[model samples]
Target: MKYLAALVIALAAVPATARPQLAITFDDLPAHGPLPAGTTRLAVAQAVIDALKAARVGEVYGFVNGFLTERAPDLPVLELWRAAGLPVGNHGWSHLRLDDVGAAAATVDLDRNEPLVATLAGKTQWHWFRFPFLAEGNDPAMRLAFRHELATRGYRIAGVTMSFGDYLWNPAYARCVAKGDTAAIARLETSYLADAAETATAARTDARSAYGRDTPYVLLMHIGAFDARMLPRLLAQYRRDGFAFTTLAKAESDPVYAADVDPSLPPAASLRERLQAMGKAPAPRTDYAVELATVCT
Candidate 1:
């Protein structure tokens, strides 16, 4: 009977499809913005890359600082990344936030990042651009304007519909557990997972609303402190939820993704600033304590 049970488990592991059908994309790697003032950006980024490798996460869009390119030319982080078979996408030069700037400035930001990504990844075109806060800018006409710039540059501007909400002020919240503060740590863990769940659900809904089909999501997460801790559990959770992780190059290959665009001359400064203004939607509640107070024990 035990042998029969083991055989059943083995059979279940086989692919149900000749080719896997689900796809997911990662945006904003190296998570933090330009190495917080007095730290080694290179070392930090390398650690993050190592974590990504360990997690077995296939591909993600990277927005690297030009400084890293200048200082760590031999690292082959980009080459290794591409060799791992993931397309490199531009996050922006200097990793500047667009909301602080305008269209003309936006163009400059885009130019710097794309070219830098090109320099590092050996790809002439950047497949995706994820804004710092997902906060590109709020003027009604500005959205179209930014898209036009992106189109000209042969780039797809990723609008993140879901996120784990790590950027708002992580570490303090996420590390509460390992630090042995049960209340803070417990809430942090729950919040981290719950935030993703909420984001995924919203993305699914938005995809249905916008595309009239449940469009797979482009999840925006930084390769940061909390994310490193959260990845293993998060990945397992997603797999159980049946979502598949995919490279940016692969994601861009789909027609549903609208990947075709001309590689126009390097974008202008105005456009780059506007690009920085792109911000993400507000996060949903991770109020696990209130929601599951009864069983949290």
Candidate 2:
């Protein structure tokens, strides 16, 4: 019994170098949330770029919703991301949720964004498609149709392994900044980092439970003011957890990410959801309402 106890302690002491890997990805690029007081799109993008560079993250994938460009024609925000060494992908033209618009409409949306992506990304590959709202469709048939279309079109589905309700905090942060609520802003920052840490832990737990080992994680974040603000600290948390950042392409290349897809299967929007779909228990939910209610209505 003492030998077994010693073995357990030894295992516990083993370093996290054997822990799962992770890749950072951003959606709703060029812009995401309403700008906080005294912030511009350029500033937000620059903050994100600088944070990633400082962390030594080699590449990040930014999925774009082309419609935003129609509003701000002069910024060349996609070019900024490309120039900074991030690749762009299609998140549809208007960020259509497939379940709402159907596969046919989603196809149109994808096509509408392609020319702009081609122009912006230049020779860089831009074949990833992240489902808007992570909803493929409510109908199995439509879901299969969409998946088949994506396969034939040579687009890989960008799966999300980790996310918190980071999007929820953006507008709240913007409101806090607008009102000069320094205390509220501090609370927002603390809660956001906590949420990120919790979700990253969840991703590690769920991946092991589902796959019998760690899988390379694809973390989903948006390009927003608060996300930019929290990014450096967030990356530091991952570093402490023994994660080494890589690109989305490299993460997806892991064999564990090659989990078989059943076209008829319902939407497995996230890694946790995918595990649940396979009848496994994922990490217990991380509640976002507690954080959002503190600052946002």
Candidate 3:
């Protein structure tokens, strides 16, 4: 679940009685890497699914890398989404942040990611996309140009509203044993919930909040082992918070948002490159904020 960190998060300020619907999404599709628990991405994803079940998660969107999907074709994660009626989309082939490279490079990255996603899903519909990092800058022109490109090729960009910096605590197989961080998993869960609540609180209070009365809060996460490790508690918290989870498609279909199927900014890149390419990023934004927008459930 490696994603470059950046944020283009747009949280609208809205009334408490008019709280927005929320959706949770995970990225680093086809995490076929190793984990401290000696668990593969496959094992971890299944654990996440089980946790979602225990937490009564209704829908999940997995943004997969095309190459990883090819490497681990047997991963049951995709099928889980299918059986559960969840949607699937592309993250990219190598999880590269597209903003770092030149236009040609970005084009190459998008071309590869899109087809891989099409191949994995075996579908020709308007599949959504989650940038490796939410690196799209405030340059409306850049974003519009990218969107037009995607529209030409057939892709819909999934915009995110909030993130809890989960990827920073990715807790891959190696990290798990490195810090003997059993509690790290629990910490990750609690911390993410807190982030969500904090964002919601801000939206509820701020005069310029990005949330609205009819808008649903959109939350972002990842598909890493650490994420799976903490998902049970996370879902429990969502239920505890009185959130009735639903699929991205259903949420987008609702009046809570005006969904579109156009493409988005340049391709994705690593976090550093995306930041360095940050010509017009907002003030004091975390990498998670940008990533959340591009990859939310």
Candidate 4:
């Protein structure tokens, strides 16, 4: 008992900054991919919101493509999201790839999404922009030009530092549910958690190597049905791993995210990007794509 009490006191003396911090953000709100049987868009949003609230996660940003809301049933998903006090940001009007469409078309697409975001995010700062597919263009000059464009529009680029391809599991999960493949769904659940844990370790290792410390991380997730189902457990796992949840704005307030938060600085480089710039290899992670693709097929 004495040893336990001493250990608790020592840990309490450690600063909050010394602990790993993570901000969770979801993309493709309103609609992501094919929904599982009997699952409504509103239900998915509600489940995700409930999970975040239950975990006491602060102000998670859900990037929206307003195009999805054109389908009448999907529009309420955004309403429910905002009603729950979550913030919405622009994910392009149609989730266009800037590289494929060029800067002119991409900027127009971005502007088209602004009004909906403005309406939903009334009195809140909604100028954060997350690139669809995280593609900033195929060349440096093109990327810089787009960065300048975003900067002029009072937008901050949301940089992703931790991701595990959570979207990949959704389709497989939907398929398994449709087919009533209970065993396959069980396998998917186990693999999903395992991959998340492994990727997190790899991201932390890379960050420490690149920055000589564990910087605050922004984890990119999708608002798919499977995500809603797994989020509560996922939040528990992150807590068990000793991560304190933070808002995107708070996490990006760190100096490491300055470029992302201020587009005028330069194109943002994530931890892996910094490692590549330094001519060092990033930590290796398991590739679950092939396995995910085959599951429930």
Candidate 5:
């Protein structure tokens, strides 16, 4: 009885395993990259929306670049996305890199995107700002200034914690589809899923290293044709890997996202950022860029 009581106490003292949480967010909506043959921008949007709906994911945010809607054909993608009960946030007007343009120009660019976002977002929270190319700024002072600017504008920075360069596959997939290369497309699918799974494992491992637990992750993706085609399988794989889908707002509500949820806080919202500040190096990720670039050519 004494031994059994001690065993029970020891078991109770061990913490329960933390289930990984993720918020899937899409960028470069209305249009992302070259569409596959026979695919329209609206069709890509519809496919992505269908996948999300089928998966029963909630409140996924599609970050919008208003410049794309200047072309009439691309406008309906936003309409279809909104009609499907998804939310839209700003990704800047021209998708300009803030580091390339100075803070003043980037601020103007961000504001230019607001009118369209405000119209489409309606009553939803449309003040989430995702930096184009995830480039906050090259300069520390500039980054801090831009963050303050975001806070003043009542915007939360949408920080990306998980990504496997999903955008890299879109152009290759398009090339493969154009050439009618089913074998190459199959290769793309395999590589895409492999990278996603590998990156998710790396992200969780890095999170544990930085925070001693897995913080809720916000996944960065683009609404490209390949992404639309693969989202259902991608989401299912995450589920199998023990990730529970969450809203961006809910994921950012975790304390690790304090800087992202409120830009007034000092920047430490990402594992890499935290590790860098701690004088430790973040784990290196496999770059598929070269392989993806040359695959279908």
Candidate 6:
């Protein structure tokens, strides 16, 4: 009877089709800016943590910028994130763009954040590195060189497969709040949630085209006032779309990570661009900046 039970457990592990999976990751941690009036950074962090807890998310990673920690040491923001049992990775010291700063300078920026994360993470592994502005380098040679540097430092690149310009809304939302424009704020909320759902659909389409199956997806978001407010609903919508919350490690375990070639570009070549380079046509993404401009003005 024990043997039969063990066999049943092993059989259940096999997949007929990839279970729809999504891993949430935040950039510009500790503080991301455009804070609405009357909102403290700690308050923003708590709101985000509460939303994640309510969603019952397993693991959501936050990429930290060391500069922010130095500026806001009084606020135990990183401590709050650690208290929530979430792992934080390096997002570079000043969030400098690799293409703009060059490979050598960028490596130094990463180095600056290492000690900070080491201290904050304690016994936890802090080996993931995300590119600022998603800029790798100006060319393939530079890109590979930086990649080698990361490898030498025992760091894995945190690649993102899903994002819908969620970062663009914070400043606009803050503006609306400052002006007491309730109507514009309402419009921003409605559009932001709808765009997030559409972006998830677009990401899934790219995965199907690229790998003929669903790849565990890494979603890029920011630590911002607006993001904290919307995350709960956004996650609920993802559940309705058949996705299960997952860890960054589990999400990257998909074979696509090992096989997909990094596109030859300087910086900010999104998943859609990468898919297009591989000869797959992905759906168009909504222009968040343009949409925000309408309400912001």
Candidate 6 structure quality by residue, lDDT tens digits, 1-297: 554354336434536354688889999988986788998888889999999998899778889998887775523999999999999999998999988877888889999899989898988878888889877676767777787678778787788889898988998899899999999988888989989988988888886675556778889999999998888888888888888989888776654553122222123345566678788788767777876865656
Candidate number that wins on lDDT, 2 or 4: 4
Cand. 2 TM to true fold: 0.87
TM-score of candidate 6 versus the correct structure, residues matched by position: 0.88
TM-score of each: 0.64, 0.87, 0.69, 0.93, 0.92, 0.88
lDDT of 2 by residue, 148-193 (tens): 7777777887888788978988999998888888988898888888
Instruction: List clashing residue pairs in candidate 4.
Output: none
How many clashes would you count in candidate 2? 0
Q: What is the lDDT of candidate 5?
A: 0.88
RMSD of candidate 3 to true structure, Å:
8.9
lDDT of 1 at 162: 53
The best candidate by TM-score is 4
Model 1 TM-score on a 0 to 1 scale: 0.64
Candidate order by decreasing TM-score:
4, 5, 6, 2, 3, 1
lDDT per residue (tens digit) for residues 1-297 in model 4? 554354335434434476799999999988987799998888998999999999999889999999998999998999999999999899999999988888888889999999999999999889999999998787787788888889999999888989999999999999999999999998988988998998888888897787666778899999999999999999999999888999899888776666788888755455566688899998888889998898888
Q: Per-residue lDDT for 74-150 in model 3, tens only?
A: 44666655565555776756666655653445557777876556655665342776777766534555555655666
What lDDT would candidate 6 get against the real structure? 0.80
Task: Report every candidate's CA lDDT.
Answer: 0.53, 0.79, 0.57, 0.88, 0.88, 0.80
Evaluation by lDDT, superior candidate among 3 and 4: 4
Error of 4 at 90 (Å): 0.7
